[model samples]
Target: MEGFRLWPGALDAEAQSQLVQAVFGALGTAPLYRPQTPGGRPFSVQMSNLGPLGWVSDRGGYRYQPTHPVTGQAWPAIPQMLLDLWAATVGGKRAPDACLVNLYRDGAKMGLHQDRDEADLTAPVLSISLGDAAQFRIADGEGRTRTLRLTSGDVCALTGSARLARHGIDRVLEGSSRLIPGGGRLNLTLRIAR
Candidate 1:
């Protein structure tokens, strides 16, 4: 009741599958790429974003914008399915200006970090877990930590005390779910980017 939420069959199965198709489809048109860190090393995972503003990371730094860097064109539009999920998941929250999409292949993991780049912490972060399930770990700024299994249709919203809290995907089990064709997980975090 406190840390996470379970939206049992929240996507009605069909919708979930459709969204996955849209995500992978867009990626095929514009594949996800590992951006270089400020220090000039490639980040471990590949990422991309959608909507009015797309989050980007590179040797320069992390920031948000309206176009894809590689394509020099507009980022793929945020699918309506994503918009609907955000509405239902956040309980009427407006459609996010930016949707950060992270693709995790089997065994891929993300380091713990606070999503502090967004302009306002008041607008909570809405995350939807699709494809395979993942072990999501949330660490309080105060040092306490808790991990939960965020599966398909699971909606995780970070707000209030936990807003801007440090968190990350510990690791994704290769074949945790059959929801998606590939043995991977797709996580989408919608936010109001400045």
Candidate 2:
């Protein structure tokens, strides 16, 4: 919690709508696909990426690549709005190299884990939430955990001491918002992978 920053409703409703459209547009090129764990178990959430690198998981292991796993095409560029958001929130000479996009629906949840695959752990990870709300959980150094309800337009970041902390979504609150045409939550995480 020492280095976690939360800007409630960072993006107003209109901005949220525009960002959603941009995300969908990018996904049109690199469609979302359910990823598998290294053990071959399927992940509950559908995932895709934007920027120079995309995070991927398969039988081989978790790593970053330049192309989509299913389409075999290069990922679309990171949305300009997100680039601006990163600049305003976590100012640095280098912008994030990856924006991992995740769609959660039907009780999809992610287990608590540290984001350590990136080469630079010092850079903060910025997360933008949209659609239905989610019970976001993160652990502190004392082994205690804190949970927050992340709704559409809400943005949070794990920086400094909290950058590599264990965090995840415990569950998504269904029917909370009507942003995503169908019912689901979209989480876009910006990270400096390399």
Candidate 3:
């Protein structure tokens, strides 16, 4: 929790299941899109964002904004369970205005990067992993490094020194669980992007 660790079932089973359903239900409204990197190469993982702000990347760069880049529509509201988990994990703190949902299909992996796009680095990032498991890598602000295997219903909070540290998923294991039909991983990261 302080440096880096996993919090399993941070959300109860009922809340977790409903959260997943809420997300997938909205997937049709604002479908996932694979944005190209700044260099014009498309990222391997397709993603979508919810809440007041959504995370996006393309030929321009990586950043957060109020409206969806494609439809110019406000992002879907952040599910109550997500906000509740953040509240339980970091109590009394204002809820994050942005929730970036990363959908990782088999063989899709995110590269290492620091989450500097937000206005305040002190705001802890609340991430939930559903459907399948993935290896999450974290490097310290200095020289320390560690690896964590995040499974379904697992949650992680990035705060204090780790808030600005570099992290990413190594890859999602295919056919790892029956939670999601295609054996994919759904990672919802909550952040105060404003």
Candidate 4:
């Protein structure tokens, strides 16, 4: 876990609530929609984005673009709170230009994969967890995998050698938190897309 950093409860409950409101505001412009894999299979999680670029996937393959795939309009600006979080946690010369908003509901889960679709792979991937806790997994340098429960208000980053590390969510612990309406998990992943 040399390149992985976990800050449990980095955001207090009040801050998390504020962030959730901001997320919903962005979603008003760019609503969450399920994305398909390059193979045409639908993902379990619904996704949207904020910032200048939005990460997308389809039969065309994974890539980042300036506008929402469905809305055909530019993505909303990254939330100020998230910008502050990134600055404090993964400070660097450039601010993240893409923030992927993933909503995991029911039994939704993500398969292990590396976040290498960005042009700036050197920039660390900063993730904020809200609502239900997720069983997060990441591959270590020793070729082994480590798992942890990422709960609401927790913030984590994948940087350095682990910038392209294979990581994913195994399953979400439902009823763990009530931050999200109707009960689910929201994962906000900030990264440099271009």
On lDDT, the leading prediction is: 2
Q: What lDDT tens digits, residue by residue, belong to model 3 across residues 37-97?
A: 8899987887888888888888779999877777778888988877777887865558899
Q: For each candidate, give its TM-score against the true structure.
A: 0.90, 0.98, 0.93, 0.98
Pick by TM-score: 1 or 4, better one? 4
Count clashing pairs, candidate 4.
Answer: 0
Clashing pairs in 1: none
Worst 10 residues of 3 by lDDT: 1-10
Which digits, one per residue and each the tens of the lDDT, describe model 1 over residues 79-172?
9877777776675446688888888884778888888888886777888888788888888767788888888877778877677678898888
lDDT for each residue of candidate 2 in 150-190, tens digit (9 for 90 to 100) = 99999999999998899999999999999986879999999
Q: How much lDDT does each candidate structure score? A: 0.79, 0.95, 0.82, 0.94
Worst 10 residues of 2 by lDDT: 175-184
Worst 10 residues of 1 by lDDT: 1-10
Candidate 1: global Cα-lDDT?
Answer: 0.79
Sequence-dependent TM-score of model 2: 0.98
As for model 4, its CA RMSD to the true structure in angstroms is: 0.8
Ranking by TM-score: 2, 4, 3, 1
For model 3, the superposed segments whose C-alpha errors exceed 4 Å read none
lDDT score, candidate 1, position 4:
42
Which segments of model 4 are wrong by more than 4 Å?
A: none
Per-residue lDDT tens digits for candidate 4, residues 1-194, read 67898999999999999999999888999999999999999999999999999999999999999998998989999998999999999899999999999999989999999999999788899999999999999997666998999999999999998888899999999999999988899999999989
